[model samples]
Target: MSRTIRALAIVLGLTMLVAGCGSSSGDSASSSASSDGKFTVGFIYVGPKDDFGYNQAAYEASVAMEKAVPGVKVLQAENVPETAESEATMQNMIDKGAKVIFATSYGHYEFAKNMAEKNPGVTFVHQGGLKGDTKLDNLGTYFGTVYEPVYLAGIAAGSVTKSDKLGYVYAFPIPQTLANINAFTLGAQSVKPGIKVITIATGSWCDPSVQSQSVKTLLDQDVDVITQHQDCTKTIIEATEAAGAYSIGYHADASSLAPKGWVTGSEWNWTPLYTDIVKTVKDGTFKGSKYDGDFRVGLQTGDNPFVQSKYGSMVTDDTKALIEKAKKSFEDGGSPFAGPVEDQDGKVIYAKGKQPTYAEVETMKFFVKGVVGKIG
Candidate 1:
């Protein structure tokens, strides 16, 4: 069977199995007030909370939610794999009095959707899944326009690379990942024309060994700088400290991971978004069907969904100034995928004097010029 068909069949089977099991006692508990009149929030992670990347960012936001929202109890399940086991983990959290659950991984989408259908009283939030709002009334999906900060980081990478050949260790070739790679390349090229980005797809998001090997492979290719789109800081740590190469990071501030070789990177400040979702739930004003959390608001309205880490002292002042200027342009409605952009085959994807819509960007599948790799 084709990959898409097989994936659909799996999701269908899982949904049927979960719905058959139905809701348990905890489903009722979520609707009732606790002894202290506090509402409980639950989070499910696909990787360890201390991975210092994606999960760490989500975990920190959960912590911030607990502190910012009074009478709120937070429950979290760490290292939950993105398989059928994730449904069981969600059930455990629901049993423990969680009214709302956030499944922070793309692979967790089907499990969360099935659970939402089985238990309508509980709210489900998923990250990087497009079907949540359409699949169920109680399910919502959210993601940031991470490309903005990624583009900014590219400026740093482009400036620091001695060979003008940078390497990117990415997990998948999906639209989301491809968009980031394209943005990073474009950003670098904007600062240093003719910069070439060599990419390696590891096929997994959180495998440390695989990421380490990819780092070594890139370094061996004479790449002086590396960046990644995975679930951990292993790439940054391995590339900078071990390989002695400059690195950019994703998901969280990993400057401490590399120290001397650390350049600026991108971060997701999910505090405001999480807080707003929780408050909406509390006020009974939550609209899952209409809630599509975006990073554009964070960038333009100061909601702070996207953050650029402080430039390392190693970064020259001129490069930092260029990044800052680009950041302001994004805030002022500028986009990284503006017209005059070309794909790998030298075909114009966006004509000059035009900008791609958010939907168009989300569906991006081709790499721009100067990027060396094929997506499957």
Candidate 2:
């Protein structure tokens, strides 16, 4: 989920049947020991394995795990939709000897939790979810607070925009997307006041055509800088190159996609978390715990690997200096959403000049002062 420099949940309540009251010790005993010699891990994707976006990053981590660990067997199912299919698919993997299961979709949370119960011995992990009380001791949830990097990208896009009007092509109106949009707008306004971030949601994660249309529509309306949360870079590359505008990419390093028009992006680096989990399991110290793929553990430059590629020498030294300063601040534990937020409908979500609390930022559901367009 890339575009120019413009900008841009929890339910708990569930339980593992095998985790408590109704579980049979026989089932739990069977799960505790693996008859297979190899470490078998399975992953399910919400999109294609090679979408060049979010799924790609997860796939890359899985691939690295395969190479790093000896006697490891990796299994993956791609193009999995967010429906009943998730539960069935996960069950099939678990039945097929998967010791560690990574369900990599927001919609797969319930399925992963349920499947974790049926297979109490197997460790189940999901991305983009909160741990519920009824959750299996083996089930874990995680998501990256990459909005911090997205904010930095917005600063770059804001500096590059000549019209001060930016475009954001988004996918879905979920809390995650909304937070990114708000953070991007705030980051831009921090650098360039009175800047407006116009947003458009395509209701899809990996539709290139929809993303392309979203970008074209925004560019046609005279937006000079663009950023997106969709899954492809083709649209951003095309729009910015055609309109001679600047853009910041998302999900992956997209400077190569628009060498002449692109700035930096907020890409996911899932290696650190993946590596740590794998190491934990290998060392027999696996506690079946929850993992937070947030700024504290997942967005590391060395391990999580978000990058800001140069905009083909188009970036002035002053601009570079500002970005470097922001980067340093972020590295020093400053928050991108440290303030005064609002929703898409202009409601005072966080109040004037007050930084949003941690819970408020994670549960954000609105646009900021200058983000134009509907939340859809």
Query: Quick one: how many clashes does candidate 1 have?
Result: 0
lDDT of 1 by residue, 1-376 (tens): 6999999999999998886455321232234434566798888877667767777889899999999998898877776777887888888777777789998888998898899899898988887777612646677877778788899899899988889999998888988889999999999999788999999998887678888888888888889888888876665565556778887878777777788888888887889888888888877766532453332353555565768887887899899889889888877878888779999999999999888876677889999999999986
Q: Which stretches of candidate 2 lie over 4 Å from their true place?
A: 1-36, 206-210, 288-311, 342-347, 351-359
lDDT of each: 0.81, 0.71
For model 2, how does the per-residue alpha-carbon lDDT over 71-126 read when each residue is reduced to its tens digit? 77777777666777677776666676777888888888888888877888888778
**CA RMSD of all predictions:** 8.2, 11.9
Q: Lowest summed lDDT over 10 consecutive residues: which window, candidate 2?
A: 5-14
Off by over 4 Å in 1: 1-33, 132-136, 206-213, 288-298
Model 2 per-residue lDDT at 268: 78
| TM-scores for every predicted model | 0.83, 0.81
